[model samples]
Target: MGKDNVTVLCNCATDEMVKDEALMDIVTTRKVIEFMEELCEREGYPKEVLTDNGAQFKSKEMEKYLSERSIDHKRVLKGKWEEEAWKERKGKCDDEAWKERKGKCEEEAWKERKGNCEEEAWKKRKGKCEEEAWKKRKGKCEEEAWKERKGKCDDEAWKERKGKCEEEAWKERKGNCEEEAWKKRKGKCEEEAWKERKGKCDDEAWKERKGKCDDEALKERKGNCEEEAWKERKGKCDDEAWKERKGKCDEEAWKERKGKCDEEAWKERKGKCK
Candidate 1:
């Protein structure tokens, strides 16, 4: 590395190459010294370093830093070929070359050639413009011719429109027919359903009436049993004994009358002496 601002630094060894590297912006002598100190602190010091006679490397601060760390610094003068080549090629872009090229043609002759070229270009452009105008007029005439032909075909157009209207009307009638059929089918289904429900209601009514008849028959049987028990007591005991056993008979009668007679009627009967 010569006397230049180094952005990147690297180290090459037998075991590792470029493993220990440092990067900096505009590497000055102070920055380079700081990096070296940090590197030595982290990875131990390097034995020797070789560099060119660059300004950053040959500075007094750089020398002091290396000496403090006991690092051997070698300096060599490096020649730059790119700078020399640029200096040699700098003389080729001179004012004399541009002056000779500018003075090659006379002013009057150049203006005459430019005017002739413009006149020829205008003639070609005018011919093309006239041709394009004629083509536009021809297109308009063809469009008018097509309109005249279409006017002669009005009879066929009327027939096509009439056919479409008839087809639409037919489709509407078919839809109405299907709708009527569906409504009739739905009404029949409803009627059958109502008949089934009526049959079930009649059966329920008959069952309810039959249950009431059975209850009446049970009450009649209980009355007959009470009559029979009275007859047996009359045949077995006297009038006084029959009167004494009447209270127990009343209790049995009350049990049989439950759910059969009205509440007020049963209460009145219970309060009677008989």
Candidate 2:
């Protein structure tokens, strides 16, 4: 806070980060942390946070509170932007160097644009005293109490920053929504495929039962049918044999009657002749 003339203020819990100015984005972890801390300390915790990784910065107390609530925290990424590290390092030029370096790694990975004005301004304000740069000027800024007089001109910065901030935030939220939809659709498709496969397998199993079966079952049915046919044939043969036996008895009785009649006739004729 020394050379930075840093101001620490809280944001509203239900505040919408507006983007009316330009494509302004949250460029530092410290900014995000402060924003969240302000909300948490003021109003309440959210059930789900849809933001960039550094957008919802965490402190120990905040983390513990979020953990207790079992709130879902999703990270939304830009092409490569809203980097926190570089801002921390550049934001607080007179702050701790190690933290500044560590924080700038992500920013360095993604820097693509170059502007002469911005580059010169950042380099000039980086590690040098503003007094040194203004040495040639006749009129001077009052250096007596710098802390009490600095906040009067920060609104222009916020205005210029609004649009990009809104743009980055929207991208994050959209990405999260798309990811959820994709996952849900994927799960539903898998479930449908599984059901279709199960139905097909069940149909094939039923067809197999209607076609090929155990030979032993067929053999049992055939044995019962053959046994019944054999009994019917045996009964018919027995009835024909009984009729033939009755006819043979009738023929023998006829022969015996014929022999007895012939003997009586011969005896009568011999008596008449004598």
Candidate 3:
């Protein structure tokens, strides 16, 4: 069983198994390769592996996999190991073979492990030395190369910089324009407000003048009415006086006629009075 609690497959030759660590995650060919790589690094490569003709072990992928690592693959016949004794016999054969090769296998495993370690260390040192050399060369060459590159790209750089400057200048001009436009609009608004205030003042003055004119017209009309009433009363008084004078004259004429021949004097007085 694998750590994931699934059925695991193993090589009976070396008792090496591929395990799955994740739940419901089956072992795949790629995983098998990765497992084998780690196993070979630790235990060295196996000479051969034997398996039944299961799908995992019988595909072209498996063939290519074993071929790449130079591992021999042997497939057992189908239904050959149905008997329990044959299974036991196969296990015994594998154990005996392992015992026979155990000493030689240990020696080869040690040599291979030591050789791989030395090779890895040598490669690491070589890579470090090469990296240092490349860095030195890059530092030395970069100064002159960069200068050349900048020389070649100067026109383009200048154009790019000039474009940026122009854009900034245009933005500044546009900002100034917007600011000036805002100030103008504010000034216009203030002027309109002043005009509105002036209009209100004018309206108030007109109303005041209209009020004064109305007061004057009312006073003049009242004065004209009073004067016309006084004149009418005075004319009535004069008419009454004239009627009284005429009555008196008629009485005097009757007296003169009774007194005999004062008509001429009365006429002369009337003429002089009229």
In the range 163-224, model 2's lDDT, one tens digit per residue, is 67887778888888888898889878978887898788778886776555645467767877
lDDT by candidate, in order shown? 0.64, 0.56, 0.73
TM-score: which is higher, 1 or 3? 3
TM-score rank, highest first? 3, 1, 2
Return whichever of 2 and 3 wins on lDDT. Answer: 3
How many clashing pairs does model 2 include? 10
Q: List model 3 lDDT by residue over 1-274, tens digit each.
A: 2222211234332233312324226656666667666656766767676566667667788789889977787766676534433565577688888877896798799889989999999999999999999998898799779988988799789998999999999999999999999999999998999899989989998999999999989988988898888789878888898889989999998887866656777787889999
lDDT of 1 by residue, 1-274 (tens): 2222222232221112133323454657877677766655666666676554568878898888778867678654356333433332343344445555555554445767777777777777777777777777777777778777676567568778778878887888887887888788878887788778778877887788788778878877887888889887776776666766786687668766764666667778888846
Give candidate 3's total backbone clashes: 0
Which is better, 1 or 3, measured by lDDT?
A: 3
Q: Score every model by TM-score.
A: 0.24, 0.22, 0.25
**Which stretches in model 3 have alpha-carbon errors above 4 Å?**
1-24, 81-274
For candidate 3, report its TM-score.
0.25
Please provide the root mean square deviation of candidate 3 (C-alpha atoms, Å): 26.8
Candidate 1 local distance difference test against the native: 0.64
